[model samples]
Target: MSGANEEPDIPDLPAADPLPRSRWRMQLVWLVPIVAILIGGWLAVKAVMERGENITISFKTGEGLEAGKTRLKFKDVDIGVVETVMLAPDHKHVLAKAEVARDVAGLLVDNTRFWVVRPRISGGTVSGLGTLLSGSYVDVDVGNAAKARRDFVGLEEPPVFASDVPGREFILKSAGLGSLDVGSPVYFRRLQVGQIASYQLDPDGKGVTLKVFVNAPYDRFVKTDTRFWHASGFNMAFDSNGVRIETQSIVSVIVGGIAFESPPDSVEEADAAANTQFELYPTRTDAMKQHDRIIDKYVVNFADSVRGLVVGAPVDFRGIEIGRVTAIHTRFDAQRHSFSIPVEIEIYPERFTSRYQDGRTGGRISDDPRGIANYLVDNGFRFQLRNGNLLTGQLYLALDYFPDAARAKINWDKSPPELPAVPRTLQSLQDSVTRLLVKLNSIPFEGLGNDARTTLRTANALLSQLDTEVVPRAHDTLTSAQTMLDSANTALQPDSALQQSTADAMQELTRTAASLRTLADYLSRHPEALVRGKSGDKP
Candidate 1:
């Protein structure tokens, strides 16, 4: 479609220079795609280089796991991803196949722990809250095994401690679990220093064995003789002193816990070895009770009602507790036709030796127990029921010297060596009061009262007669006496003639006394005055 009007150039146009040949032959527009290809190749090599190992984890459930969504994390750092979630051949477990980064290859060991982390609340701790927002992830705890592993069984729950956490574990054998759980705290002197790791019932099903882990410095406190006890609930006790409530901590009361202590005075062979076995006492009192080396069994036959006495009641020597009641039994006497209560007791003979320490009854009994018993019995050493707590009415067997006690003997033939016991002082007081009450009840009070009432009635009638009859005569006599008194009063008036006459008579009597005294004195002067009465010239 070219027009024919163009004229030919005079020089033939130099053959239309074919797009000038140059060293930079590529087009500017094509350069962009070539550079992009180079970058893409480098990225492909990087992806192959950074790829991680593939691992299969078996979980009890596939919850919170999703293919290509759930990530494998070490300390919350994404290291891999789950490629598939499926069931195992047995269909009992979920298998999560994942790929972890090559950098963490060393962590894929035989003992490595893996678990799915979601929002969990347990043992008073709330964890994995972040997972609620971001989603659950497969968390790994690096292991330190010499061999590597590709397949793993995820933990039913998270591991309580990291493998590198420094601590030791101990085994506690108990008759029962006693409100214990895996994460129950462990205490040393009321300070939380550890937790329960695991537990299993004994093969014989007679007890449970619990494993407890104590963190570093506290683990050193465990000793061969260390005592463990259930410090779960608040220990409440009421005694003669007062009510007492004791607990390791408020948390322990709610969650349950275990406590351990090496007696302050105890000597240990060494810090208990790892996995050392120990016994768990039911209470701190039992755990702290001193172990007795030697024990003696004896029975006391009491005549008084035991009332408040029970098994485990203290058996006291003077004021010191040397034994405890173990059993209480009753016996019927055939000939006497009476029932007697026999209390079986356990006496720690060590308490009687010099090695054992006590303020009262220290080394009072000899090592030769039989001979000592005989001698003590002869010297009025007797067992008697005594009131331990007056308000509680608790009775206890007491060994004391009763100087006036009746003679008695120990029946060694008895299996437990029967020791005679006397009634408590309260029982004696009760008996005396009963006898006095019986005597008072027998008194003829009604007859005596009737006689007294009859006598009172007779006296009342006599008094009535006096008031109606004899009283009038008495009043008449009183009136006559009153009239005479009035007359005498009138006659004895100060200005009356009778008073004047009385005064005159007193003056005459005085004058007569004076004359008599003068006469007497003159006679003394003159012995012949009587014969010469006319010679009194002083008149």
Candidate 2:
């Protein structure tokens, strides 16, 4: 405003255009970053795609497995990611979509196993904490197991590494339903050897049947003579020493397992000629030593021979678990009440010696009962009753060799006897108890009743004599003394002596009554104490 360019304030010209942007410069700034972003996305897709290599994995249930998040890991390193999850046509396996890393593409082989690594304690696998962070993953154990390149089925865990193939199949039947849980393991010498493949109820629904698999070299040792028993839980006994069998570890317990003692020398071999198709229960044959016709024939009819035994009573030939009483029933005839029953029994051949040498001859597989019995008796053999189930009062035929001189000979017959029918039913056992109660009720009580009456009469007579003779005399003496005192009081009326004397008498009377009450209570509870204090009194 001063001189101005003293030209009178020419109006300010509008601001000139802020320089225009060049197309080349614009392309450098904006277009480049957009192109870079596109390229980056494409690269990520390429990296994640398995390209030519693919593998399938299975999961028990595909509840939480979102294909994008579930990854395949090789030693804690992400090697692939699940791209898709499809249900198998058979619905037995869950087919996974796996895209392997370029470096690990060659590792995918036909026998490659891919199992879900989730929080579980089953069989030989345990991975609880990993499931907490990232959910379950397909854990790949790269191996040279399979020769050809083929599609793989992912397992729930790594395939158990067995040295060789499994041998014979063993069937275990357990009474007391629901004792076994699914996915339990089978062990040999405390080492995980196999798993329980499946379980089902018998046709009659009386028990559970277990299909136990024994793998490889170890399975060969489980011959027909092996002993199988439930080795789980706290088995405590007071005799000899308290035997307690506990789980070796916490994880092993979740998967129920079975352990059997190794057979002597005979090894079970697979019948390669036998078809892969299996029978639920084939005519069970001994896999150890050849069965003797005589012993086998005799034991088959064991139930018919021992059906007359009591419920809690033992059917001991000498003390071995050959069989047990399964059920009892009664039949009433027109003439009299009678019972004919079929008893279920189990005979395990392992307890007896398969082969023995007779003293009269050389060593051989003896079928004669006398020869077998002689061998057993000499080796301290005896049969006794074993109480296996205390709740049901059930007994088992147990065989144990004892060096006792009073060994009894067992008469094993080729056929069961058509002897007189006996009481073998639950109803019969109840009837026995009822008969005992009736006999007890028949005992005489009349003589005892008369003695009790005489005692009561004696007590009442004694009470009467005390009341009439002793009590009345005492009352008269007290009255006389009171009258004499009254006379004395009249003479000393002015001195107030009679008033004080009456008060003292009342106090004395109250104390005497309290003492009498205490004495009465004591005598009632302990009448004998009163007689003891009085030496002349009879108890």
Candidate 3:
């Protein structure tokens, strides 16, 4: 009993300090698991807040797309990540599922555009080259749509420019695509200012329609009369001047491009509206030829062969181009019952406005076509076919004053007033030559040749006689005449006897004159003494 009491007392005495009950209630180790639970809950809530929405984009192909690896970028900033890639039900396209950041969710709209970005060579340009090593990525373009969307169709090709980019869009209609590509550059005065956004066949199937974008400052240059043309490939032109080669740039030559230019100040100025339609010319020169002027159409009937005449030939007035040949067709004249070539031409009367003046009123002449036509007809103006290029055999119509042309009235009542046509010079010459050939063919050439041969033989014999007999006789006569001339010259020499006798006669005449004067004086003095015997006179 004593040992148990002592041990108990000692054990109690060793821990005599009192401890709080609350402190002993629960150990700190017991709260570790609860704290860990709370931290996990906070992390879960943060993940929920940061999670993004899932979107499905349909693409023509799955090229360069990798689930969980492909990043969606906007303005070079990562915005989303591709989550999965799968084929659609119809298998017409590949479905790329992506998870975009919550902050960019509003950007995924109906008008948003998406495309894959990889190393691409387009329109003579190298793009996305950095993607080759860093791997391909998806590109997103935000839209102005008010309604948001999740599902979208991806563009097969990247857009030339973003929709939100400050630019103006215009529609260009062309007969052919030419050298223009999707990303072809657009130029203004040889300076790069825009690009070819996209192209498609016209709904009417008449031509190809291209959507082009011009940057802001450059868009102002596009007026209502602005001209657009394909300035691609090397332009090589040969004319009277010489060879001319034109190219916008090396890139334009390699791929293709479009260029635009505002018309001269002569044209009325008007801002071109967005999406305004314009014609795309094949060449810069062709576009430059276009002008804002009233066009007058006329028809001409040619009686001569128009073998070398073709459409698009120039209609010139004194070497100045005034119009073009629109059509060349053969039509049977019902009234005349003869076939004639009907050439339709488009004349720009406005081109002559600068020279227009009313002789009577001294004011600007009326631009009315009828008035101009009447004036032209009264002034002996007529249409004539001429050779444009003698070597190429190209034919053109020339308008000039033909005062001696046959009198023919213009059928003003006809639908397209017919201009009087004069006979082509070449055709008239050919006809005259043909008539001459016919006349030559009709002549008795054989008989004429025989007569000519006989005459030639007679002439040859006569010439031989002249050469032999007549020639020698003529030579002898000439020699005798020369000898006579020499003899006469010798007889007429100053020192000859004839000359001496002439000189003595002159001296005697002088002496006689002096003696006559003295006798006359004596006769006057003694006129009455001896009238008959004056001064040694025989009385």
Candidate 4:
């Protein structure tokens, strides 16, 4: 009964309420909320798909850091954003949490460098001026490695060169870091081709090792025999060649720089590989010197003073440089009771290759070094100190043949070997002057002067004697001779009696000679008259 009552009531009520057919299309008012929900779903999906990695960067300080504000940029283009900045656990630095775009995943590799961008003046370069207007930002330099890392150490200073600056790296070892720094320029023929990337003391603490990057095209110019030197400031040298000064450029002088050059005369060699190690010479002269392969060290004992000789003084064969003086030492000879100067010379035997070509072929000059040494000594080869520059008083060593020099031999048994040395030309001259002075000192000049005075006195006395004695006698004798001559003149007078008597005697002698001449003629006419003679004459 209850069912019948409830059914009838329900059917009537349903029929009455037969509620108008529900519309198939939603209302315009509802469309607004539906569209908003759809848009919200689309945004959620997009965010999920485009989500980026969260990276942590440790910085020494967060001077200009601001969460949700700073951005990571590359080439002035934003690549990431800083989400948060907090103090590190150690409190020694600040940790920056950043969100980087997924597209730059390849850039987040090992060696990727990051630093803050702000107005900076460093190493003579002004950078990040735009950061002043746009506010500070995080800068990144993607590295060239395969490994990737999310945690990074932020750099305090900006990198010297970005990866976009195509170049090759090289290593240079120097005795000391003169004026070189990270931003110092590298010059190839005075053109800025690169810069010093970094520098550090050697592990041994004996020298400095510098990393340098040579820009692409210029890197090819570096050869296996390339030489590097400090081209900054003044490259001054004072020696036999006199004073010399050299500099790459005014900029280099102000900021310091490195210069590299390959010897023009050197053989064509392959380009140096990346990260090649080279020696950084103090000056270009030392860098350009030909490398000597064969060095023969020998000691030369000098009796003369080496006042002007220096360690780097060149040792020449005749006029050709073959070596240099490496060191000089003084020794006391107990046996001889004298101090001797021993000069240690470094001789590059290879320097004589062009001259003594026979040595190369192993002929009379054998490859055995002692053989050459013996031959040289036997042929009167000796070492002599020479004045290289008169103004600088620089002395060098000269090797030449001296046939008249005292005989000597090389003592090969001694360490470094021993060679004979002659006195320097100046020392020899000084010694000669000293000997002359000694001889002059030995000469009895006072005695000579006294003898000269006595001789003058004797000469005066002799002159006086001659004037008082011989001169008057000679005059008297001359007068007597004049009288005799006068008498002879009187006897010879034409009107004198002796003259008349002489004429009569001459007439009688003439008659006698005429009669004798006639008798001789009669005898010559008649040969029989010789015996019958003058029979008529005899009768």
Order of candidates by TM-score, top first?
Answer: 4, 3, 1, 2
Itemize residue pairs with steric clashes in candidate 1. Answer: none
- Clashing residue pairs found in predicted model 3: none
User: Candidate 1 at 276: error in angstroms?
Assistant: 2.6
Q: List the residue pairs that clash in candidate 4.
A: 532-535
Candidate 2 residue-wise lDDT, 1-539, digit = tens: 47644666578889888988776665446888899999998998886663646666666778556788888887789987888988989997677777787788777766666666667765545645768887877777666665745477555444444223445456776664233444566666667676665667889988777766666666765654455445343234455666645453344454445555533543445432211222221111222233222212122112223433454233344443333344444434557564334333333333344324232221224456467656765566644334546577554555565664354444445342111122224445578899999997896679778998999999999999989998999899999999999998786775577777877999999999999999999788778785586445665
Q: Which stretches in model 2 have alpha-carbon errors above 4 Å? A: 1-50, 54-64, 74-79, 85-95, 100-112, 121-128, 131-135, 141-224, 240-257, 263-314, 318-327, 332-539
Alpha-carbon RMSD of each model: 14.4, 31.3, 10.9, 6.8
Which 10 consecutive positions of candidate 3 have the poorest summed lDDT? 355-364
Compute each candidate's TM-score over C-alphas: 0.58, 0.42, 0.70, 0.77
Which one is best on TM-score?
Answer: 4
Candidate 1 per-residue lDDT over residues 463-483, each given as its tens digit: 999999999999999999999
Question: Which ten residues in a row are the worst by lDDT in model 4?
Answer: 356-365
TM-score of 3: 0.70
lDDT of 1 at 354: 59
| After superposition, candidate 1 runs with Cα above 4 Å error | 1-61, 65-114, 138-154, 173-180, 199-209, 229-257, 280-286, 331-338, 354-367, 406-415, 431-539
Looking at model 2, report the run of 10 residues with the lowest lDDT sum: 274-283
